[model samples]
Target: MKTMESIENEEAAPRAEHQTETPLESLASIASVLAVGLFVMTFVFQNFEIPSASMVKTLLIGDHVLVDRISLAPPAKWAPFTFYRDIHRGDVIVFLKPGEPDLFLVKRAIGIPGDHIHLRNGVVYLNGVAQKEPYAAMPTSDGDPQHEYNPYRDDFPSIPPDPMYQVTASWQYELPQHIENGDLVVPPGKIFAMGDNRPDSLDGRYWGFVPRENIVGRPMFVYWSFETPADQIEKQSISERLAFMGHILVHIVDQTRWKRTFHLIR
Candidate 1:
């Protein structure tokens, strides 16, 4: 028996007041989100920026990649849920440089532990078999003369390490011990890595073996890429770095390599 106007008025009346979150509660919620993000970045994933063209055509300079820190990590009793696996040949890896422990480097694992490795005119022979490496680049006539075929660089340990080739002092002494029948044997708990831009890269050939413990993780994909100069990393001064940062902001829209965004890394 209620009139339409009276029913409408009753329906429009406020039902209940909702409680607003207190400032302290809001802060706690934010803290929880930050904690989760920190844990994920620290233990599960890590961000790395490509500073050199060592892995060019695969990973270019200024390519910001996300590395999966858990997969290649040693298995842990407490973190049984994590999927851990051993490093394998042809896997692109990020690791601390053997001699320069503080420097991080990215390269392709050409030879794993217990593998015999050697190079003949830029061809990688592993375990007495020549590998079909399509990613590797050999020097061309148009390329820099310095990257041209050399005895120590192309022929590897067979020609022996020469002082002019920038071979590490320790590696020069240790190189002979590992060579057997002209092939350099990768000892246990070590990896032989090389760059895709073979001629330009100063990798395992110039240094030495990468320790298993030095392995950080494998890059999953490139999150972002910019057309950065090869020498940008050399600018260590604060003013130079700040100037480049400003330049990036101004040219970001035009210089960003949009096509390479989210590209998968091999």
Candidate 2:
């Protein structure tokens, strides 16, 4: 017969083996789940980065954003997609170029189809009425000079509130007037979009309305963020060099927005 000590030792051996295997199995399961999640995010939910200061105060440059592709039903007709199931006024979005199919862009959807949009004096008007721009933290300063008045003309009129930021053709009064100067109207099956950074952004004022079909998806959140170089990411010898040069490629690999990393896009 086996001694009590011997039997106890035998039982302990299996217990130790099982304990070791459980952790390994759990780790494997975790890795598998993580891989699946990444796949889903790539196919269903896409990510983007803010390239310009166009949508400043609202969306800063270097911000990492998430775009939702699942919401956009596949293409249907020449116009494309299930049309629009439902798109709100304030929802920020990502999309392809209605004019240049090769381009991708992000901007806040301001006016929808059938809305008469333009700058009256210095304010934004929709359908002959002014839109209540709560999001417009900053407004034109003074003068009939507020918005970009004439395309043929260099400066129409504008008065920046801050004396330091005064008005002139060379000054900040210059809004990105899409193709022509002054105000533009949105057409059917298209919407007008503008960036928060009025003076610096090249938006509807330059390219015109974005076609409904070009809309890729709504931005749900800012999943990840990084501070990368303008030259873009290339293989570097060190992390410091990468941070400066080889760094994160927001437009196209890695950047150091350590503070922004994993930070929620709001």
Candidate 3:
């Protein structure tokens, strides 16, 4: 006859064996997790970083943001609940660079398709009304009267097209076609975007309208922020990039902007 403890152990052993997942079940579980992850990445969200000071004061350089891909999805007649909402004025968005499709950029939507957009001394006038932008970052003082004045930056539509100030050869010719009266009339399928740091940003004013298809998503929040040099992330060699990564690891604690972590991006 077996002891009571031995008898209990024998019974528990078979139960444990029965509870073990089969290989097929294990594979299915892994597949389910992967599928969910893929779906989220493809349709729900994506990671983005503030690579430049174009959106300064609103979003700082080194701020890592999560773009909500779901919000920018194309509308579907059958799936009203799942379709993307319309892009609105003052909405900050991440999009593919109009001139360079490979590059991504972030800017505030100042005008939607069909809206009249213009600027007077860097103050944006949308639909003939001056839209108040509390998020915009302005310079403390106007510097240097002799610094080659860019009429396109200060006063929009008032200045004729200049090859030197235009973003691209095509834009130089196409910009005039969109001007109606004194405002730039956004085409039927494009939106006008601009950076909050108006004086420093190279944006739609230089390039052209942002195509609806070029828009990726709206930034939801800053997941992480590390105070870094403005030009540290610009195009660099592989060795330089590796050096930067190592530097980040060493000084993460010192450089991390703790207050900005999990900060909701407007």
Q: Which candidate should be chosen as best, given lDDT against the real structure?
A: 1
Please estimate how well model 2 matches the true structure, expressed as its whole-model Cα lDDT: 0.59
The TM-score of candidate 2 is 0.59
Report the lDDT tens digits of candidate 3 across residue range 1-266: 99999999999999999999999999999999999998898778899878888888899999999989877868767667875688998899989988688999999998898899888876778888887888886443457442234577768767876767646777788899999989999988898998988777888888888999998899999999988787787758999888889989999999999999899988
Q: Write candidate 1's Cα lDDT for 1-266 as tens digits.
A: 99999988777664322356778999999999999999999889999999998888899999999999999988999999889899989999999998788999999999988899988888989888988888888866666795777888888878878778999899999999999999999999999999999888999998999999999899999999988999998999999999999999999999999999999998
User: Model 1 — TM-score against the truth?
Assistant: 0.92
TM-score order, best first, reads 1, 3, 2
Error of 2 at 191 (Å): 2.7
Q: Give the best candidate by TM-score.
A: 1
* lDDT, residue 122, model 1: 89
Q: Is candidate 1 or candidate 2 better by TM-score?
A: 1
lDDT of 1 at 32: 100
Model 1: how far is 114 from its true place, Å?
A: 1.1
Residue-wise lDDT of candidate 2 within 70-106, one digit each (tens)? 5664554654543446556766768785546887887
Ranking by lDDT: 1, 3, 2
Model 2, residue 225: C-alpha shift (Å): 6.7
The residue pairs found clashing in candidate 3 are none
